[model samples]
Target: MTSSPSQRLAWPDVAKGISILGVVLLHITLTVPESKDTWLAAFNVWLDPLRLPLFFLVSGFFAQKVFRFSFAELFTRRLWYFLVPYVVWMLVEQQTKRVEYHWVFGDPVFDFSQMTASLLVGHSMAWFLHSLILFNLFLWCVRKLPGWAALALSFSPILFIAWQAQFTSIAKAIMFLPVFVAAACFRDAISAFASAIEAPFKGEWDYRSFWAYSGMVGAYAIGFFIRRTWDSYAGAVEVTWLLPGTEALVRDDVHILVRMVEQFFEVPVGIAVAVAVSYIPVLSTGLRFIGSHTLPIYLGHPIGLTVLYGYPMALNPREVSLAGQWPLENTWFWLSMCFVYCAIASLVLWALGKVPVVGWTLKPPPIGASRRTTEPPSAGLSLSQKLTETRNATTRK
Candidate 1:
């Protein structure tokens, strides 16, 4: 079926911006010294819960389209897109001690293998790249298949929870498939939801606005909650929750249901807030700016945040001790500043993409080469006659 630009879904960048911001918050939570304080600690705990899931969901939402490419084309294009940069950065990362290198065989090897694996299976922030690659592959295989088939394939997450207890690698791979599939299978519903909000509903209660706001708010609430809870529970809850066996699975299933319920309420709350903010001309315009640049923001934010978090303390001798200083000192201020900073960085990255060398990296490659055509001979002849004439002509030449 033909899809509109709206159906194409413009909010990926917005979601990407949110995802990158979540990554930043995760890093900040882990690294920030002041987090020892009660309130900040509590806040970070909450953020961790939804931070990574939010990123994975956004990825799943977009993976359906990637299912269209041929395997060779998809692998060659995407593999190199991330691989080239990832390798380059990991090498550079070694210079700064940002990466962990390992001994493989008798030689000390740069662990490009882990980096590569991260691009395929969800591996922390690295999983974003990994899940993306797999999701694209998985979606391509099932895109033309029936919706029910696709969803059945997507529901593999249940198995993932079971497997994660014994086989982390297998579990992660299986778990991610469902999320990626969910985005594709639910594409129609999500689009319908978006459209419903674009129009006005009776009274002030617009369904679209509600979802958008809910997703936004829920993103934050979940992010804050997970981080706080993990620390408090010593990260045991997540492990217990993912463990195998019927009893653990049943118990975790109940927790998952409860969390989903809370998320249902929280996401709408967040989305409602987003809707209200969107109605305000200034905030709306600002979100649009952030949303527009979100893709670049996603790719580039790692470098920028690395600078903000990694360098200041490393270079300045005393800054490491005072590194406890928060970027904006409060959620509102920090988030707003992060939004602006990422937006500007995205714009700059966008502009840089216009350059021949950089542009190639930012966009996906074309699917196929242009077909060439040659005109048939102006005059027609019988097969035997034509063969004889061609032979005679060749002899003469």
Candidate 2:
């Protein structure tokens, strides 16, 4: 059932909040070898299964309209939403890469032709947005197909794994297409399931305890175990499926069993995370706020990350493994810095988006969009408006 206008579907935002925050933190720590052994790293690793899966899942949930939208409608509402940032940020980041490449690799090397080609082929640092474009386009193309046929066709990309190897470039579109399609197609069922989980927590103390502890903690513990032993599990189960052909065909690194296990865990892990977020009223609201502004953080954080190269990130070479060292190697402080960085990027861009010319860097001009097209279903709410509503809800509460 659709939520009432007065009520919000809180979990999507919270899940997105968790995913985006983890993504930024993961990017920040990408160069640090010691970080891999930290508890914060484990926390990030535990979230690995939830990270992209949940992002693509909730994105497809929100994009259920694409299944029915006309091509024009798709372009205005969805395509524009992703393409703007994908193109604009990739362009911006390319500039950063020019300087960064010189610093890291001992001389600058970037081809403009390659940049344009990569953009056309959906390759960029903003890969999430790129994959979304491809996924949405696929949906639009398949919109006319019969239900079962469309559903069946969506699985075609999962077959691409047969061609991917640990050394080769991955097709992210194929890697994540099924998750996106599943969420878009099965959003109602998933939302209903999530709500059913949260319902217990909203009731009596006994029910709440059951959900808050037994339910969420149990899921987290399982996820923690799965993540901690992920390497061993993947290494242990290495069955390669070559296409129905000769030895020249591409190889699959880990078997289908690994993917099956990971995806099986994703559903419960995501639901548990959402339920936990909703039960914490104060924290949930804060996460929802962060989630709402994900576009800003998603676009701007990469630039912030690239800009911080020489400062927080220091390179230390070892014979066996090249490692990155942080000046102040405190895990808690590093974790705290990640949050502050995301928060600052979101806020600064949020404010700059109101500035005429400068705003283009963050939010693109909604091309081919009418005024109504520009006004999304939510039409967006300001922070002050949300605060006002909270204050006014006191009597109702």
Candidate 3:
């Protein structure tokens, strides 16, 4: 039996929500110097393998819809959707940082050259948006290739990035490209798998709980070990060494090898986690809501972090010391701070979206300038119906 579109989409939305929360926690832990060396830090490390990879996978899942578009349609859509926001936000982030720096140091600091370079390379979290545009463009170019060949071409940069580790922007885009492409290429397979497992849970409580809890436990256990193995190797390389050039090469090789190994497990683990979480009705609903608004939250969260934590620390360390104290030593506090930041950021972006032209910075145009005769499917429609509707809508354009 076919599941409703809401049911089919729930897992992906939950996965995205989980991933974005991970992103927020990571940023919080890293930004708050006091939060370092705590359990939250360790948790973030353990979660690293699952976070962005899962995100990229979901992005690719949706990109399948875009792939149906003609080149001109796809190009224009991506430009408006990804590139415009990226450029606008890059400028906003840069100016915000400059102002913060001037406030803290009592001297104006602005570097047009450095800003330009950073924009070209995607210097910060903004890199995700920039890289996403590139990924879509690259996928568009390779759409006509044979499946295996297309995947191979998309994933070719993983080795180079693993060895060099310096081509931050391009390397990251390439590293995650395979996941995205896999989603596009195997979209049917993924949906089938989700449907198969979710279908059995219709009324069977024992079966549903067993799979949900087991998958969650198994994925986390395997994911943790994979990350630990990578960490140990990374540590060994840092402490033990050969000749200078040889040592660097060895370290890079080990890092790349471990990363590849970790990713092998990470991808499945992430999917399992998403599936498991989706079984919890309450949590699933909350995550799906967050996932739906990911674009705004992703764009705006960093600003909230900067203004609330980063700027205060930079501008007046003493004044903010008390506020930052609790998060430093308490894991609960740290987690709370992360959630609080995410909430504020999401709310701020939501408010911005309510405004007229200002809202455009956080919202993208509709996927395609397509017309539809029938009303779009409600949340109750089946996945297959929704996909058919999407195709029909695009074809009409």
Candidate 4:
């Protein structure tokens, strides 16, 4: 029996859902004072390799379609999809920070200088949006070049930055661009592999399923060990065998070099885990819902965490620290806080997306300026409806 189109799409959505959840968990683990040094923090570290890289890889998986659009269409879509949100959210984040600063310090001072700097360089968490816009433009500009040459050109800066340990948002974008481009280039191969993995499960456990399952476990295990070692070393080590006279180089430089090497292995492991996890229907279904609205969840989760934790910390850092130290002593409590923040953020965004004008903050605007129809916004669609529409569109194409 053949798998339905919806079934085929589920894994990618699941993968994305997992990635976004990891991102949210990572932020929570890092942001909450209580969670520091707990097992939750260690879990977050383990998840670090899978989080953003998987997100970018998935984005890349869809890039082939975007690459086909005309310049006008591309501009319109990207503007609505990335740039507009980036600008709007950056302003919102900065304004929130300004207010937070004042409330915490008992001084109503707006730091124009810092805001101006953020504008020039991408704002805090909003950098991902800024980077996405730039990556699209960069890829388009080099579209005429031979594929290998284009990839090489795109990768050069990333290598330089990685070696130097200079990790600005722009550098991070450059680092991840190759993954995105590779996905666009090899979408068919990936799709086919996913299909092969799913084929056996449609009937009964077979050799293919066994190998697929084993591969998934093996990849995840390798990734886990890699992350553990990377953390153990703090990305700094002497490699006299790898490079002669490298002892002269500073620990930071060696750390960056080790990180660069670790990523080369880690990203593929993330992709493998994503593909492997997709075969499980129940897990996929739950994650698919979260994956579908990742944009809003991504933008809103930090705000939710900030509101929950940041205010109290700002008001009385020492008091908040002492209070957090106790509850966080329980590992389960720390883990639950991560889930709670993510759930709260998702709910808040979902609620905001239901409103008319306010929904624009969470969902992409309609493609053209003219709103000729009284139809509801796309955000209102159920998961099944969205998946069906996607399948129909893929079939039509």
lDDT of 4 by residue, 1-397 (tens): 1235334466667778988888887777676555666776778777766677777778877766555556776677654678666777677767766667787876565777877788666757777777777777776777677667766776655334433333366456555767666666667766665665666556656675677657666665665566567667645454333433233555554444444445545665565566567666687667888888788787777776666656655766643342445563454454566568667866887888889988777666767532336445345589998888789889999
lDDT of 2 by residue, 1-397 (tens): 1366667778888888888887887876664445677766778766777777778888877777787677887998778867776888777776776666665676546678867876776555677777888889987888777656766787675555554543122345544566777777777767766766766566635554455446545655665566456555533343444564233332243433344346545556776677678679799988898788888787777766566533235253232212333435554455456566656766776888889977766666666643363443334568787677667778688
The sequence of per-residue lDDT tens digits that candidate 1 reaches over residues 1-397 is 1144324343444444444556655554445444445364466545533444445555666555455556765666445465544444433334333422121122344456754554444443333454455557667778788877986876555555554544344544453455456656786765555444544432445666676555656665764475345335532233344444543554334344344434433432332333344455665565546655544655555554444444553444232223334543444334344445545655666777778866755654343321224234523567887788789879999
Estimate every model's Cα lDDT from 0 to 1: 0.50, 0.66, 0.71, 0.66
**Candidates sorted by TM-score, best first:** 3, 2, 4, 1
Itemize residue pairs with steric clashes in candidate 2. none
Model 4 residue-pair collision total? 1
lDDT of 4 at 323: 43
Per-model TM-score versus the true fold? 0.59, 0.76, 0.78, 0.75
Clash pairs, model 3 backbone: none
Compared to the true structure, candidate 1 yields what TM-score? 0.59
In model 4, which range of ten residues has the least summed lDDT?
Answer: 238-247
Off by over 4 Å in 3: 1-8, 103-108, 162-164, 203-226, 234-257, 319-338, 364-397
Q: Candidate 4, clashing residue pairs?
A: 235-255
Q: For candidate 3, write residues 1-397 as lDDT tens digits.
A: 2445544567888889988888888887776545667777788877887888889889998786566668767866555678778988877777777777787877567878878888887886788888888788878888887767878887676445443455576457555778788888788876765654565456544564566546656765775687686666534454233433333444555555456556645676677668768889899889988888887788777887777756766755642232455545444564567568768877987888889888877765454543224344555468897788789889999
lDDT of 3: 0.71
Once fitted onto the true fold, the runs of candidate 1 whose alpha carbons sit more than 4 angstroms away are 1-13, 36-59, 62-124, 157-177, 197-277, 315-352, 364-397
Q: Rank the candidates by lDDT, best first.
A: 3, 2, 4, 1
Better of 1 and 2 by lDDT: 2
